[model samples]
Target: MGEHVRAGNLDIWTEQVGRGPEVLLVGGLGDTVESWQFQLDGLADRYRLIAFDNRGAGRTPMPDGPVSVEVMADDAAALLGVLGLAPVHVAGFSGGSIISQELALRHPGLVRSLVLQSTWPVMDPYLRSWARFVRRLVEFAPSERAFLEDFFLDIYTARAHNDGTVDQFIEEVLAFPHKQAPRDTQRFLDAFIDHDTTDRLPGITAPTLVLAGGLDPTARPELCRSVADRIPGARFEILEGEAHQPFQEIPETWNSRVDAFWRELAPVT
Candidate 1:
């Protein structure tokens, strides 16, 4: 269901599914097209969904020199242009949201609308400190499992933890091949930490929706709201009792909410 597509300078690994209006899903740091399995399955009936592995993640190879959000945004632009899927709806999660912001700014013609989930406009002191700790943990963790266990703490809600969802995630990740190397993970984190789009939000011409989890520790509702406030006519919504990854924990609800937003813009026939 996936193929290697020549986009930009890399042979980007991409997956496409379903039919109808095109929708592109962008994942966070260290994520791949597999990260949106739930969406690919749940939303495909109504959307022509596309997902891809970012540079240095999964099947995509890292290019020489450094990577930045702008570079990654350009990559997305190239992918869409190459596929002739321009003016498509774009949804970005966490670090992907940052890249999406840059994409909307740098290549506005490629984007029809934007959905930013678990997004932040700037890396504040709190997030900076947490990112620093994460870098240290990545550098020092004894094993991959150990690192993921600690990393999932900030990503999922208490309910997910209590209901064994986090465990399931760990099991799947451990079983999946093409694990992101530590160096690549650090490189992605470095790009995420250095990104800032505070003054540039107003430049994005795409209609935008910003969603945040009420219980998310990393991209808190308050911070996410600030992003919504900055963008003209962007809607902000909070999924109560959810954490950073509601799309995985509650795919049906997440998909329905997103579907409704898109429908409001262009009614489904």
Candidate 2:
């Protein structure tokens, strides 16, 4: 069973999984906790997993206000307080990475090791273009599914390598809480588009693992490298032949890499 939380004035919804040290998994723009399907099972085997829907997404209950990634990070910290867990390992992807970076920088005691995949800590050309692309789709597209079908072709490497995955992704997208609410989707997108934490990266103290796809159109490897370079002693790696969704593109490799990072950080028995 799960419930809602009140972080000062902000509201949030969070779910906990497995048991050990807590591992918080944050989703990207308008994505639900279901997006972390790749990391859930494997990570659950080794540690507690706390996956939460960001404010204005899922069942978090946002009544419409300015939503900043830093404000969302505050929600994450509040969620952990409600859960009674501290200094947990945190993992985030894409839009989620923005929150993760803020969480570590602003609430250093609330984060242990970090896994940042297919993302950067700051805004870039990719984020700006996609914000317009999605807005245009909502405004002028003849068919929403057709719009996503084309959009995926450009962002996700899996579309070309495994067409079967797109069907599942579409289903997953539909299941998201804001899927049918354009205003809510736009708010989430706005928060993502405004995400720029370049000046804040030097404050991130958690040991970090930043992964990027060699061909990812959105969060390129160079951007990921910039994140790693900023974080003290953070490790950066690129998975060959993968794009925005490496965990989905090469599950075995992606899971293993994440598992290894968590294990390496865990205290010895």
Candidate 3:
């Protein structure tokens, strides 16, 4: 079921499925709860999976002024607190992974375990350029089709693009009712660029899993490795041939890896 939780001034839209230990799923900058459709059922059977749209996306409208990764993390923590779901497992991707880092840092008691996928602890020249270029493209693109065409290349692998999966993705994106505004996207992109948790990884108490795609251009292998290296005992896994959207590209592998991590820590009693 889906409902709105008042996270301070924002009315964050949240969804829950199944019934067990809670697993919170945080998505990318402009992603909504639907972004985790592939993992919802797969993880829900074993964990009460909770997914929500961040502030300024989907049902949550952007508030005035600038926002930061810390704000977004606080929003997630607030939602969990309101729903009585502290110390839950958290899995986040791309921008969401950045927020997850902040969540683990600021609300350590609320996270039971962590999964950071296709994310970086610090934004460097390469990632900064990509974020800037994407913002410019979204602002000046003549049409949504042109934007999606350009975007599909960056997020999907060459094989997936050639195999028609990219086409389906474009269609799904076009079908969404609440498309992210270009300005809002730029704001979130800025948050992603400004976020740096490299110095704080050691403070995390949760068991951590960092998953990266060998072929991903966005969150490159070295970037993910650095994030994992900072967290004590954090395990890093590489999914060869997959790109930025590994969960979507290889659902079984993504879901199974996360499930195994969670199971080992707190098996069903």
Candidate 4:
């Protein structure tokens, strides 16, 4: 079950499961706790996982005025402090990864380790254009289903589309009760496009693992590599045959890889 917890100025909706080392799972733009469903189910047997809806997404209400990456990172930090879960393993995907980078830089003592998936250190022209296009779709797309159908093309591979995986995902999103408003979605995308942590990533002290998808168009391997290159001792790998969200597309493989990385840091006794 999920409940709203008082974190900072907002009541952040969070869900937790399992019992072991604590792990925080952060999702991408317009995502909620439900986004980490695969991880919650796959890794819960051996680890305690906490997943939350980012501000301006899901059941979480957006605060007044604009939201930035730093603000969102601070929200995560505050949540940890309130929950007494500091120094926990943190895993972030896509836009969530950008927020994770800021969190590590701002609250080094709160993060034990970081697993950044489909991340980038800076938004290049290609990425900026892509962000803008996504925002435009949010503003002008004919309908929610239409927007998702068009947007999934960049995130999923041809195999997923051909095999009806993307179709099922779209249906799930449609069925979900707490849908993100188009304006809020645009705001989240805007924040992502404005963020740049190129020089600051080196300041992160947490053990970090950066993973990219071989077939991802949004955050390509080169962009993801730049993030690892800047962070000292951070390992980078590409999940071959995967697209932007291998966690959803190939949950078994994704869960195993992330679990292995975490286990290496704090081996079972």
In candidate 3, what are the lDDT values of residues 1-269, reduced to their tens digit? 68888878889988889888999999997899998999887777778899999988888888997699999999999998888888999999999999999999999999999999998988889988998999999999899989989977889899888999999988988988988888898899988886788899988889999999999998998999999999999999999999998999889999988888988998954
Writing each residue's lDDT as its tens digit, candidate 4 over 65-173 gives: 8789999999999989899997999999999999999999999999999999999998899989999999999988899999999999999999999999999989999
TM-score of each: 0.99, 0.90, 0.98, 0.99
Shift of residue 27 alpha carbon in model 3, Å: 0.5
In terms of TM-score, which candidate is stronger, 3 or 4? Answer: 4
Better-scoring candidate (lDDT), 3 or 4: 4
Better of 1 and 4 by lDDT: 4
Report the C-alpha displacement of residue 156, candidate 2, in angstroms. Answer: 1.9
Instruction: Give the poorly placed runs of model 1, Cα more than 4 Å off.
Output: none
lDDT of each: 0.92, 0.78, 0.90, 0.93
Q: Deviation in angstroms for 208 in model 2?
A: 0.6
Once all C-alphas are superposed, what RMSD does model 2 give against the true structure?
2.2
In each prediction, how many residue pairs overlap at the backbone (N, C-alpha, C within less than 3 A)? 0, 0, 1, 0
Candidate of highest lDDT? 4
Candidate 4 lands at a TM-score of 0.99
lDDT tens digits, residue span 48-123, model 2 = 7888778767777666567777788888998888778898888888888878888898899999888898777666
